[model samples]
Target chain A: MELENSGRESVLQIALLGGVYNNYLALEATLQDASQRGCDEIYCLGDLGAFGPYPDRVFPLLDQYNVTCVQGNYDDSIGNGLDNCQCGYTDPRDNHFAQLSFDYTLANTSSGNRAYLRQLPKEIRLERYGLEILLCHGSPRRINEFLWESATSTQFLEYLGKQHQADIIVGTHTGIKWLRQLADQRWFCNSGVVGRPENDGATNVWYTILDIQTGHHGSSKRRALENVSWRHVPIHYDYRRLACEMEQEAIPTEFIETIRSGWWTTCLEVLPGKERRRGRF
Target chain B: MTTPKVSLTHLDQLWFQVAGTLCNLTCHHCFISCSPKNDSFGFLSLDQVRKHLDDSLIAGVKEYYFTGGEPFLNAEFVDILCLTLEYGPATVLTNGTVLKEEWVERLRKAESLSQYGLEFRVSIDGFSPESNDPIRGNGTFGRAMDGVLRLVDAGFLPIITAARTWPMEQDAEILDRFVQMLRDSGYAQPRLKILPTLQMGAEEQRTHGYLDSERLTDEMLTDFDFSQLVCDHSRIVTDRGVHVCPILIESPDSRLGETLSAACDDFPLSHGACMTCYQFGAICSNPSGQAYRVKSDEHGT
Candidate 1:
């Protein structure tokens, strides 16, 4: 990711893709959509491989599109040749599936890809449209932090921003997209992943488009929250092809079901009640 | 001769002993020996809870947890939880014996309104009545299961928390039976959290107290992750005052101070309960608890 700080008055639209999880099909669709939408820059909040087929396929596309990236828990683990994904799942069943996914992604990820992931920054702070946006995976504080929409408190997000000295923080590791604004100025956003469906029982996946538009009339340094318009852009992708390739690669059918049906068949324990209630389990 | 004391790294979770020692059903394995008559500890009113909630603002409490002999035994339990939802995500640990329909309905609405999750961790000792009733009490399983059904029907996925008093090897079989039972009983997605049984109070007589060697030593802290210990990131507010943890509420030494900030002092892990916590990682916290780990070393993100 670019460390350069560029300030501008013009509308800055950036696409944030979170946790590809090796779904190259969705990655392709998301990139094309972002391009057609005239996204100024596309950033991927790490975890490049997991759940889907051919972990290496998504790398070339990411390179072709010039997507700036942040290191996720999976990327850190795979890059360092760690034993586990370090998602900190406690449930026996959740651990069982996490291990399988980790092993597959790590084993299949190319050594060069691992090297590329290892060099990626943990956080990317870029000043755009007078707003300092900090892009990270999981959270600014911890790599594997699961900031679920329901489980995370606004005050806590505020603490992360205050502690980290960022006006706006964008993170994704929970696989769900949510944004909470403080005084309509500072914000915390989870760029929904393109890895798989959001466990919302829909075939379509999602990525986020942060549309930082016209700031409120003020001599104050901070921009108004109303100026920061963001949306979870739903992307309809070739999920069937992804699932077929996943089956061909002998990926877990449980994961394949999540891609096809959009309900998470695994990693349900980590979800809080509100998030879990939204899914079919 | 020195007892290992764990530092309060951060105020991640704040527990309110809402109902105190008052409970409708006296489980054989209750750590506090809470019964209908056990008024040794007392209820914390909504007013008292609000005060602590105010105090928690300064502490930056990430989550709010409600527990007791049975939290619903308190008259203002639902109101307390509703108020807590405004601040952060709230979780209530219930015996699954006394959760009323009106309360669940109200809580469901409160949860939907709040951005945070309202988690209900229901205590069900066993998968079957025969196994569960002997420990929890006769006919207690039916009532708890009823409560579970009520929560499920209300679109709340309550995590069925069971005590692993049996051998570790049997956990898989027992959990499988639990999932199968919940599925058979119309709960399609059953969330289960297995807890290590604390050998203290009623359980001490029912089973046995911890051995002298079970205590944590400073040497043990060499490379141990302090975040795994609830005392490192949590404090429970009882009517008496703020206690170090839910498990050692009965122990006088567990009382840190009157306020959450005053209770920031490191706790001496002198009791047997701390051993159980040391063996298990953050058992008191919800499953989502593992997400907030202490940042890794120099390679930290």
Candidate 2:
């Protein structure tokens, strides 16, 4: 993804999308929404294929919208023809569904697209208004790590910020959106996935918009931290269509159920107690 | 062959042997042979835990885990949990026999008030008393079930962690039965964590101990991701000192140092338990724990 900004503008609003998961319909709608909202840039934290059908469809939309992307675990696996999506679900039932999804996506993803995924940077570092923003699929330390909100400590996020040398760090892998501002004015954002609902018994998925007001010359760290604000924008797409498409592709019914009902069915094992309790499953 | 060595990648998980080797009920398969009389280790005071919590913050420890003979056996268990919830997510591993409704109620409230999760992992051996009582102890099953009900009533979804005492082939059937049993007990949405048995301590007498060959070797580490091993990313703080992991606390060599920083040095994976950890990655951690799925062949797909 393009990290270099042409100039330090007064205000910069960027759209951050997480794991599309082959949900081209959501991708299309999200692009339109982001454009209509007048976002200066759009970036997708990857996993461009999985769950939803027609793996190749997401690429054209991403290209059309110029959405910069970072490689996710699923993308890394698919791009390299790996045996499984490195999702870290240890349960046999979860692994069964994960494998099914991985095989389908790997078989369906075009060679060119796979190569594109293989080359996508694991992380993207951007300098905006004196703010060093780091975007990664999971935590910067590991590609497939699940940094769940309830389980992740503030100190840990701060450590990640310092370790990665970023004022603001954004990642999407746990499929839940959360924002935490650390004691040092550093920020961590998990831009929730558009691939599926957040298992919160809500059908709508989400993305995030980070608005940074950067015009003040020689802005202090406090001023820059204050200028940054993020909003989790719930994106409503044609769930019925995606579910039907998944059904047509013979994707597991449990996955389709998650798309329709917004509660995860297969990968419930990896959820932390609090996140699991929030889900209907 | 030389023993494989694993180093701490980061202090991701900091465990506390809170109640230490002092459990109310001594199970047949107690890995540490902890019992009412076995006070080889001692309970960590609230101040002690607070100190570790402070130390953990500097190390950027992701989550805190409290295990014991039974963490709830400690008088200040609830206070420790509540205090931990303020700093980060906390998970307590208990036998479920000693859980009080009042404690659960306070914990539920504490979790709600905090930004992090407070997980209660209740240990049970089997689906029914016939199977579980024999291992955990006679009459312990009923008491544990009562504790589970109390936890559920207090709005907590306690993860029922069962050691795989039965045959591996029976895993699916056993897990299904456990889920059904939990549901019957009024836990509508039951969460379960199935654990592989660690052959040590009292378990060595109850079942066969690890064979002489059961040890991690240097050759085994060639392609394996050491991160899967708990020692690669975790350390347990005991009243004695910070150890390599909770499973190997009894071993003298497991005591890496007295402080979290000193314990970050590499450890030789020579114990029989290291073989079990190699077989089952991150077995000591919650399923939601951080993991890196290293490809067996990094160069190949």
Candidate 3:
């Protein structure tokens, strides 16, 4: 029943999180949830600060959980002392809020933490269970790209898979989770973000769990499709407390509204029509 | 003495002047001056589109866009879009006055069946008829709103694209009113795209054309991200030939070649419209594809 002809283990379970955005409570909840589910590995796909309060609180948790981290656009900005978050928002209102968050995060973050972020890799590549997995904050090509589920095409994903030589390409940054299966069992997964509720009317945030196992095709061929399953695991954390902290820190009230109502209040101008319509602005 | 040349980085967006220099409305700000009875450029047959679609796949085109005097004016517009949705995501830019319910219904079905998105960008200049009628035409705002509602009824969220005709200070107020108008018209979640008016074509007469001094010098692109320019990432396929970019289709120098492969040559930053693209990056793309502004320190390489 095992497809370990390559002289390696043929099963792996990994938990993937993107855009932490300083939501230490959600990160803690996600860590505990992943551990309880017997995840073999857990990874944070960058963006350690923004929106929420207490940027330093996230560092200790990452150390405790031994989560591998990749550099995100926010991380790059904070680490390099860049002028803005490079979130690609065009509206003046969106830019205003983004600047406030970026300035606050930069001012609050310790120099050590900024250095840690600077040293993080733009992409993390791993091979396990006969699958070549690539983890990145956005697409493999750009750090700030937004690959929204509705706007991105399967052919485009396939092109990414081919270009990167990845059987599974996982990314985040759009703050929503989605997955598409390409030909020959190739897959693209947006692990979503724990920073905020995905514009849906739900308080819980989401992460992705990929369970890769031996071939299930019941065939003798070694090239058979591997049993790769993806699940969007929702993490219910103390969002109300986070909202209070945001208010106390004098953060934009728009951000707090998103936390309380599970509807995005800012940085919405970049959303495509399909994705934008899914949310209550 | 040579103009700056921008090479094709990748054919990320492939455009079809499907309806050519033809449109239902003759808005004053129409950059290409697309209007009724202007058949300088002809509609691309479905066969022509099919050939280019096949060619685009090899070139690694990420998305497809259709435009015209009006794409829907072409009898095979729906068929062309349905076929394009099979290759990748497709966006159609229209005047919004001429849309049929049956076409929307069929297009909706096609979009649902495909993994790619089918975006309809409806062009209307102003929030009300009183404001829009002078620029777009008499009684045009109502028709466009009706088209938007029909699209909503068909479960399609069309992006309402408008050129910035009002004063720059009133942008926020204008956009807010536009959103409210769409909401009142049954599009509960209206998606809006605000475009900077290109001072070319009819716009040159309405407002003023680009000043003589408004040109990109070699020094201007030093630290500038040329990728922000649509010519760097996109090319349009027309019945005449493959053009450099959608905005410059009327220019004699805009035509690069007859084939996409032959059209990958570098383009000169010579035209006044190039200045518009330089000022506002990726004006033709949907908001999702628009380029980010370069940091202040990164400007003027």
Candidate 4:
């Protein structure tokens, strides 16, 4: 079930990541954690450049760590020389900040890295111990769609899984990580990003570790997921260092505040009430 | 010239005209012309809602919406909302005049128990009674503001939905006053949604009817994002049957079918209101669905 990103479908332990947003320090931290934890594969689900500082810093690490990348809305914008990041914010304030971040990331990213982004696949499929996994930037349908945990319904997630024919469908444009078990063994997950702290007033950004296992039923060896689970791993990177770098780069103080404090400052309008209320913004 | 047909790409939003053409207020701009005396449509019972919620799941409905002249007019509204939460997230459109503390509390409890959020889109026409009362009704501003505070006190962020009765240039000034009013009333995290006026039903009389030139032509839809139209992803379940959209329920041709699956078909964007939807997307949807703004040209489709 592998899509353009790779030829092989076989995978056991995966460190799923998303919303890189130019935070190379956190990306470095994530790579170290994934390697230390014996992850078989590392995937960065896109938005490789945004928010932090020195957009080109993210490219070398993706190459160095062998992280499979997918094209996110931000990546698509910068790659094709689009005006906005296509982050899908209608509010004037949200649009203003989004434009600023897009301009900065677009200006800073090198041509070589832009080529890499332009070539990334929109989605990737994986077969893990007989389970079909679909990895997308947002949902399986649209790139910039925000599938918030509260606003999104269980039936809808179930519908997405059935429509896409994947046992597990994971996306990460919202920057908030959550996992929900659908009917039967099917699951939907948001592999939260290391780009910034999840709006929850904590400096530790997050990622997901999807573990699949097989057990021997007496007298038979089957490739079913006897034990399949995912945990949102918090990556405690050197945010103070990242904050100083952002200051040096003259990134918006609003963004630097989100890096220092876990609460999101800009892009507040896009959030649903339940998600919005959780943030101090 | 033939009008462009909008196909049902997906049923992202499944709306219910729960209260039917009945409202506590007789807003002059009501597209459906619902009022206390008017009963062109009736209330939907809890059983009807239960059945539809199940059908919507099979139809791949992402979210559920309940609207009316004002949704709270129906006696079983709260019960209907509670049962809807069992299936998916629910958003109810209300005048904010007739909501009781008990209903709000129960809804708050139902929302807390479910993984899905319960959103209340309070239709407050203007910032003040001087502004809102003339449109919604006299003294409606006081009552709706009271309803807003009550929702805020009960830990609900009711999106203060106001229909734009004034000019576009007045948006900044109006929004400023609205934010100030909400914050002054102790709603700290105020969420606001502004809507464009649709010329139909009672509103057709208030404002002049759409000219023939205002209709959407087939060529206009070329390279146009069909997803911008609600009919592409949404259908309203009325007591009569499923309609193309919440705005076009009054049109005889808008009724697609009685069942959710049957309603998933192509529709003619021939009505004047279709032009309104073309101008403003996220019409009946919550803020989350507003990926693009009213000025669709601001962001590329």
Candidate 5:
């Protein structure tokens, strides 16, 4: 019956990748959207915690929805066993602040949650709605792969070639929602980071719904992904409340300040200072 | 009122990944997360590199560069460098951990043979092993120094590139420490290039990546210094194709086109790192020493 429903309806397949830490309101809204849209399945790509005020609130919701999530570097960092977040990025300075984010996240996550995070796979390959899709936190080659729209087509093709099977490679971690097709082989899309803005300075987080269909475009049996739409779903949450919680959790002052500043220190390109609100501060 | 004409030019620099995605030591913060097991980007054959060099020569390219998991890891690195020097002044960017005495001698000999200069840029994250080893790998500092010393012995003054993971205020002390280390290693005038880490790749996990706000829109380039941007003039030739700039090789859009001629179009100002390049002109080139220099006490102090 479920299989029949998928065929009859242009069932939109949706997967939630990492960077969606603890914005329960956003998560709930997405889940609600999924339920309303007659979406077949919803998957959570890890990172489930960090930077947000609530890890406890976010994890159970994921389970409740049966969202398939893989452990991101932050998820591991929050698990308490790993010496570092193992985010794959390194600081020559061996920064105290970077390590602090890991500490606070670990202190907040529960044992049961840690076990669940520990069990998540690095990459997942799925044939959803008859389309070959590769779902990963970063790239298929490595976990925490930062595949941005700014990357070269050749670089995308290289990863696409490595897949040998995927027609579409979807990733998270770049906080920016991007969708692009590379020749006939594959389409690389990032679900964008739910923890922050979508790099466009918009406060809305990103999520995608792909309506897959079996069609013959040329002289071939091709499963085409149609109506691939992404929305920067905006949810107004009490950020001050989240910031205060982060501060109370003894997360680094910088980490807390990041929540306040709404600026990621690494990229150094994005994040406009909210001069409009400066006088209020 | 008239808008200034924005003209795109031929790619002046051609960067090639000689040894592909396989590096000798896996740096914890490698932007591409390149390692021994990672062969997603394969080493370019000498013939392949020569083909790109031929393309560059025809296109009148101004510079050439070789980068890799570790460029020296390519067995034909010397041959590739020799081939590159024939066309233009070449720079081989390496972590400087695996420089062999024989390889250094060959490089010097090749430089002498060509009218164009051959430069070696070493990747040195920190001045000390304690600081560098934890991030690069254990015993990497000592090995890197050996490589640097060998280049010095061979009469090739290598430019040491250190990614500034430290605060901006602390740059003077860091540069001083770095210069002192280089002097102690016996290079009379130590050339250093301080780089800011692009928070992508393996480094993304080591730290948070670019924020949602950290991206470049097309209009931002209007007031921005696009001339200094590597993508403005340089193109990288990988095993598969030519890329816009060396920094954005991992990006699918980084590939400008297959050849230098094909890449000679106005590239859209994309990537958050392009903002960094725009903020500071010509992050890849400099007038004093090479393309870029570290914050020196002479300037910063």
Candidate 6:
């Protein structure tokens, strides 16, 4: 559905939605769908390389789609010549597979992808949307921070108040789609990773459509932020292919299964599986 | 009842740190500062909890609750709830990050099978990550909401709990925003609970522990109702043993005598958090819609 208030003014829109791993099948379909939905412009949310097998194929497609890309936590670490993924996600008690997956993300990121990643900004600000939309790999303040939609409004307001002025804020890192309105007149949204399926145990990539709709409520035309509509739409994608590609990439069976099942197995802390072996996490 | 050196109250509710010290994600403000490495507490095996069930029944306990670094992190969480439901109504406090469809299904099944009702309280610090991530870690906000959605899908409505880090005057404005956000995330009927932060555990170290002034004294009890505290009527069952109350489960003195029956003696509300309970009665008894009725008189009215 269209953003509620949009009657005529062009809606400022942006979406990476999901990471486009080499699973071109899902990527192609998702890109087609997103492009058709009247998105003002498409933004790619990071995780360009590492994990899935089709980096060669996927990179080209993203370029073809002309998606504006940001460097993910993984993209930055690998590009920096660091052996770690630098995901900033710490599970003190990781099981085996998680360790393997983290290591794999580090080992697999190619130099070409790394170089591209190193130049990526932690965030990009958009002024055209009539809103200060900051695009980043993670939270506006912290690249590794995970902003869940369930967080308290006060907490959201706390972070928003500290950052640059923006009517709407967007980030990726979390690989989940959620939109929240903060008390200090800011909107926070996360576009789930395309390369990685969101942890809902469902194989769906998510994105939001921000269509400009006219506001009928309190239309004094005095409220600078009045006439905008933002709608978050989550769509299902084929995780089976991503899982298959992950297995082929030697991304660890548990990681593949986690992606396939859309469920979180035990943390890397609780169950460290064979970092080199194929098994349950 | 003989009053010991400290005010003694009968156990009113049975609470357990079922998830132990393991959390799927670590938040900066966790009172216990639980994380992947912090197993200061261990998971409660099914057998350990079963033993306490018998003791609770014997002691005439009325309600039960399960909390942790993240309760859902426990492999046997579903099983634990299923079993606990047979004895008394149960509530599970969680970060709501790791809830998958399968787990939600299992919870729904357990709720339908048990005579007593089951409730879930999902904690979200800020309405979004910008507000939450600094406290809870990155990507946590999205994951937690996914957990809430799973609860809704399971046919169980969850109570959304938030710690008021903002000024008290901002409460109404903050709540309205929270309610709107919850509705957007598939929780049409959101139950909200706002709590003041406990300055102990990880929090104390994060900022400093209780100022010497924060502690409670005998004079503080002059107008206080002990019944307001969960310890008055509650007991906690853990792998080690059954404790006097949920609030005191972390304190060594609150451990009681181990088994639910043996732990029946009076408990001392010496912790600073106890003062908070004394001031704001029943902060944790499922605030509004209690799934099961517990006998409140044991803790003291």
DockQ of every candidate structure: 0.55, 0.55, 0.37, 0.39, 0.01, 0.01
For model 1, how does the per-residue alpha-carbon lDDT over B255-296 read when each residue is reduced to its tens digit?
A: 999998889998898988888888887799888767534333
Give per-residue CA lDDT, model 2, range A142-219, as digits (tens). Answer: 777889999999999998889888999999988889889997678999999998898988888899989887676365
Write one digit per residue (lDDT tens) for candidate 4, span B88-162: 888888889888999999999999999989888899888888999888889999999899889988999899999
How does model 2 score on DockQ? 0.55
In model 6, the runs with Cα more than 4 Å from the true position are A1-281, B1-10, B289-300
Error of 1 at A82 (Å): 1.9
Ten contiguous residues minimizing lDDT sum, candidate 5 chain B: B292-301
- Residues B1-301, candidate 2, lDDT per residue (tens digit)? 7776886878889999999999999999989999999999999999999998999999999999999988888999899999999999999898888877778888899999999998888998999989999999999989998998898888788899999998999988888899999999889888888888999999999998999889878878776777778888899999999999999999999898888878888899888888998898878888888466545223111
Off by over 4 Å in 5: A1-9, A23-25, A92-94, A158-164, A213-236, A266-281, B1-50, B53-160, B163-301
After superposition, which runs of candidate 1 have C-alpha atoms over 4 Å from their true positions? A1-9, A214-219, A224-226, B292-301
Which of candidates 3 and 5 is the stronger one according to lDDT? 3
Q: Write down the lDDT that model 3 would get.
A: 0.86
**Model 4 steric clash pairs:** none
Candidate 5, B171-282: lDDT as tens digits = 8789779988888877764566777777878888988788767766656655443445776557777877877776777888777677767767666665666666766555
Instruction: For each of the candidates, give the backbone clash count.
Output: 1, 0, 4, 0, 25, 56
Q: Pick the candidate with the highest TM-score.
A: 2
- lDDT by residue (B175-225, candidate 3, tens digit) is 889988888877877778888999998999999999878888898888777
lDDT of 1 by residue, A27-89 (tens): 999999989877899999989988888999999999899899998888888888888888887
Superposed on all Cα atoms, the candidates' RMSDs to the truth, in angstroms, are 3.4, 3.3, 3.8, 4.3, 20.4, 19.7
Each model's TM-score, in the order given? Answer: 0.94, 0.95, 0.92, 0.94, 0.49, 0.49
Q: After superposition, how far is residue B272 of candidate 1 from its true place, in Å?
A: 2.3
lDDT score at residue A107, model 1, on the 0-100 scale = 91
Q: Considering only chain A, what is the TM-score of each predicted structure?
A: 0.93, 0.95, 0.93, 0.93, 0.77, 0.78
Measured by DockQ, the strongest candidate is 1
Model 4 Cα lDDT, one tens digit per residue, A147-262: 99888988889888888889889899999998898878678999999999999899998988887653432322133444566768889999999999999998999999999999
